[model samples]
Target: MNTRKALYQFGYRRSPDQDRPTPAHHPVVVVGAGPVGLCTAIDLVQRGVPVILLDDADRIGEGSRGICYAKRTLEILDRLGVAQTCLSKGVTWKVGKVFQREELLYAFDLLPEDGHKMPAFINLQQYYLEHALVERAAQLPDLDIRWRNKATGLKPRNDGARLTVETPEGSYDLDADWVVAADGARSALRSMLGLSFTGEVFEDRFLIADVKMRGDFPTERWFWFDPPFHDGRSALLHKQPDDVWRIDLQLGPDADAKAEQAPERVLPRLRQMLGHDNFALEWVSVYTFQCRRLERFVHGRVVFVGDAAHQVSPFGARGANSGIQDAENLAWKLALVVNDAAPERLMETYEFERSAATDENIGHSTRSTDFIAPRSAQELRFRDAALALARHAPFAKRMVNSGRLSTPSTYETSLSTPDRDAWAGSARLGAPLPDAPMRDREGRPIWLLEALGGQETILYVSNGDPPPCSCRILTIGHDLIDENGFFEQRFDASPGSAYLVRPDQHLAARWRHPDSSMIERATRRLRGFDGGAA
Candidate 1:
């Protein structure tokens, strides 16, 4: 029987005697089946690491959770070979209008979505995005995805960890070299580790309604932040595929979760926000969200990922994407450690980098709420004036809507690696590999990432010069980067931009063009042969 009876049974019966999926002993155990956990499982299997992924969801994407998929998330999906499928099904919008009742207050467009390195932001239902990830996890031969299996107990062994799981068939114990917890905000495994999630719970309850609606309810996201008509309420409406639209209303501390769920109250609020009278309600949820971060993401044999590690407020769709990035970061590091390419200390950097990221996102999401509904009366008046000012000044539009989105952070400070060297300050330290066009010997355009094959490397920007034999060479420049842009247009010519890029796509080190002796020094750095070398 499915433990959660309300999850639309979908053939999961109440009786214990039923055919259940056989669970096998897996080398790596992932305790959650959300996007983050599934991504981690796929990363492991593709690299030849046998893994088992477990989740309590009867089928994937049933959870009416995360709705926004960012550019970084899409890049990860692209690496997993699911990006095209995702973009095909999802809607892409570049314009957003922030309103105050009837008058448009702030309007802005997302930065060039057809970015060199990534695709525009995508809007797919959380359910749909989850399905793609879970399906990919199901395809890997080295990976096992047990849908109804729930992690009941965790025990650390001498060399690895022992996972005790329960399913309808019965209970069994499995062993693994490592354990990853993507179980979510109320993470059981993290609790078992005695970790504390610390943050503040806001004083308002947010209601979400997914309904089939009529009327051209605006293709772009419409936000009514601190509208003068409503003293202390906020509303947002966004278009989904087909006739589906998501309408949200802010309910303050006085909101009764059960009482406010009534169709009477929900329908009216949705109508008001959507500016449509005819529509069928699909789902309605009234809940308050919290902003919290785990005290520590790593605890010896176990590691926390996604919402399990941090619960950033969902104001701007950072939570799910951040978790996926967490999985990507942790996956390769764990693989390297298990395969013995690097020391165990490398695993510690996972917590160091991702935790910093999660914390920053939490702060951004928190600030975003202030614009949704100002907490102070003075702030409310200030917003009204700011809107008036932005009306006359172009900078106001940019400033007010500056955080309707967020970008992935660059990784500048990592665990000391031998490759650590002086920075050129020309590149973003932890950003993804810059997407510059390249050429084959036959003179065809190829993506730089295509040449690297998503593995570790040093981008030797050769300016018509042959690089020494010690480093991986990518003869780039003269075509991809536009000189007028903020970033340096051409790489250094002498040794060129000799940058060591980690497998995770973060810059490890960069040096000036190489002399023969400098090439030797760069080579030693590439293989972790420096002062910080393990």
Candidate 2:
């Protein structure tokens, strides 16, 4: 017996492409309508690239799968025009507390700084996110979302790929210049392309239960290692919207996954942990961790994103957050490639940067899993010692990883030009630009990121003499005045200093003082017109 309600159910409609005599063609076809696919479609369409989004399911599922959206993820959502909705409807949090057997250890803040438009994190049901994305997609005329349209077969080609899509009415052939496989972990397109993930799968099992009850629990992440209720096991608590709470409990490797999810078994565990039986189970499931990813995200004209490309444990909230980042990173480059503005090799950078990010995420996730679910007695002993020391020693607290939460990945790509002079602050080469409050030319308040737009622009600190450059330039003190001094402190800006920002908001290059030739050369390299890194 489940206590869940359907949020939205979209009806399937026959696409006119199926009625055409020959195979209908599209610029880009996104093979899944999940968050990643929707994001990919939305970003591409906003960039003037028409995208057809296909999903096998016509409705958002009842399960609250991904509840935590990181600050970086929220920023990307804001760019796509849906972050405000998520913030308004979801629970916002930044602090997390870790415990050992009912003993208080320590709490940590995810975001201690201010002057940013988004919060550190937000907890909203995956269904609500999908609904918001769907609503956004509807507003864009170039984004065509096909419900109940499933991709069944694929034929790879040099110019593009051909997909055989199956619908309730019948199956039809569709050709696309490029295909994005956001179809998830069990990707049909991945199998069709003969791709396999390479990594480790932990044997330990964990149960997730979303309970509904009215309580005064503060909005924060709580992780307990070997709590009193579940002796020798771990438990996690998180507040969600609508008086719901997410609980995760480690069930060891040998526990019966099927039996653990039963209401009778789940209810008892909740009663012991909560000291009452006032909660109703909304959703329950058991899962094992698999830290894995494809060797290459790009395969000819077919690209994989989200679970189709990588998989990570949910402990760190890395799974969905990383996937959303994948969409953003790929969207801008893919649009440029589709528009013939950049070389085909530009896609290689997407493959390189995102794969590096996946490896970083996998490594962290693997370490977290090892610490959380120690396989041997020696490993468990080490974990116990670390937890004991974490109570007092700050160094030991850093060692204890309940799950290091998700953060934006800085790409050390060939596209980023090496600095000509020493630099300081968090505005390093190949990092996402830190947001700061500033005033636009009209004296209106705006964010540093909001003014960058979706193009490579030059961020120049002005001394009343701007550098001569052919690229778009946003001159500080002229276009945007940093009244709060945050932009100056965050970027270590000085008069005549300039920074090149990528379309995805990452730093591409910077210099203390640069001429027109220097700016043009770096722009060429970033555009993939030049060969080696500058």
Candidate 3:
């Protein structure tokens, strides 16, 4: 027998006061210690809100789950102070190739436009991601991470919420002014609240295996439809750190998951795909795709985020990426509400914005699942014809869908003040501010996102006097100059144009000319005050 422990087996230290007290009150109590939960805790702490995070498991995730992190997710992680660690430990890839049998149908690059700080995507194991987040959370004094603490019961009150947590030694009660449910797809808190998810559960099953090997396979997303090695099925290959490759093999609905996972069956498939059996399997799992979400994420003082609120197929890497974005969207709003800077109604926008995002992800994931595994013969024939014509026709190539890919959703909410004048650039209200490289006041190159940090700010493109505002002012032509014209070209900014940005780095409003009253009105609107454009 092999006497070696698996990789990423973190030590579990017994938590303090397992049976000490009851009715411990906290400003915020977050359930689950996965990437989304930890990210939420870190963000809240960074925003000056104290939080207690609870998780049943002491260690990180077991497998290389959710390996693909999108660019928008990276930017959000950047604000949480872990983007550099992820970038250093991740495999960056932008190009993806699609194939039908032995013929390469099309190749595409996700980031055709350049000058951005982060890449289109990066592949890193989920365990590594959680490790980095835990490390980052440790640096903040406001975040209290409790391992082996499971939330078994939840009771929502008008003024606050009460939770029952079970520890190794015993169970205890906790009172929280606000509760954030990041528990996951099979959330105990969600269940305790009697909430149910609604969406489609796909019939097709997929086998995900993380195999350790060394080969000349390029660091790119390679997807195959009905390949010779894997006859009558689809496969996806992605490169991750530590010489591990993620292979997702689509098994028919009726395939025996247990038999397919056995080494006797999996090893031969690996040998056939790689032309060798030199690789070692690190982890393997069988799962069916699901597109499900709660009708609303916010309930009284309790708020749901990440997998606890929504789930989607892993096809577009939307599962984890969208969850991380949920944390980003909720963190700042929660902070404002807790600090009394914004009314509790501001938190309701979290439901409106993220529910729309969930719908968008579920819609795309459902389409991708249908395309990859068509239920009807007519759909299969259409897919095959599209794949065949993609090799020769550009239009057909556009129609070919391996996966639609994940992108940030633009919110069309009452919070985003519409533009009063004509704008030229792609940046719009309620969308994240586009990043561009420029020279800082110290004559050092910095990305716009790096300069913004996590504060509400004003971006002005002018050499003239800046408008008087309480927020930080980023003067483009004065403090920072557009070296390569990226800032001007990307934002479509003219002289004296100013943009009001939220603490989450989203554009709240923009003006062709800097107007102090208008900017102040927009800022007030964001803080839940009345009398502003909606």
For candidate 1, write residues 1-534 as lDDT tens digits: 011123322233332212335434456789987788888888877766888777866765342456677776787777886777788888777678887656787776764523254554777777677777766775777776776778888887666777777777777777777899999988888877678888988777888777776666556777776655344577777777656777677888778888777888776766655456788877777767678888788888688999898886667878888888998888888887777776777777787888888878888877776665567898677776777777678777755642457567666454323333455433555566555455555666555555665577666655667664555555445433323332344233243656666676666656665455655554344333443332
Tens digits of per-residue lDDT for model 3, 1-534: 111144444444555545456687888999988999999999999999999999887776577788999998999999899999999999999999999998899899999998899999999998889999988998998888888888998999997899988877778888899999999999998899899999999899998888899979999999999999899999999999999999999988997888888888887888888899889988887889999999999999999999999999998999999999999999999999898889889988899999999999999999899899998999899998988888899999987888899999888887777888887776877889889999998889989998888888888888476555657788888778788999898788888888888888888888887567788878888776753573
Query: Each model's TM-score?
Result: 0.86, 0.99, 0.96
Stretches > 4 Å off in candidate 1? 1-25, 113-117, 226-232, 398-403, 415-426, 437-445, 469-471, 477-495, 515-534
Q: How many backbone clashes does candidate 1 have?
A: 4
Each candidate: RMSD to true structure?
4.7, 1.0, 1.9
Candidates 1 and 2 compared: the better one by lDDT is 2
Which pairs of residues clash in candidate 2, taking residues 3 or more apart in a chain or in different chains? none
Rank by TM-score, descending? 2, 3, 1
Arranged by lDDT with the best first, the candidates are 2, 3, 1
Per-residue lDDT over 1-534 for candidate 2, one digit per residue giving the tens place of the 0 to 100 score: 346767799999988999999999999999999999999999999999999999998888679999999988998999998988999999999999998987879999988999998899999999989999999999999999999999999999999999999999989999999999999999999999889999999999999999999877799999999999999999999999999999999999998989998988899999999999987899999999999999999999999999999999999999999999999999999999999999999999989999999999999999999999999899999999999899899999999999989988999878988887987787778989999999999999999988986778999999777466967999999999999999999999999999999999999999888888888888888878885655
Cα deviation of 87 in candidate 2 (Å)? 0.5
| Winning candidate number (TM-score) | 2
The C-alpha stretches of model 3 lying farther than 4 A from their native spots are 1-22, 531-534
RMSD of candidate 1 to the true fold?
A: 4.7
How many clashing pairs per prediction, in order? 4, 0, 0
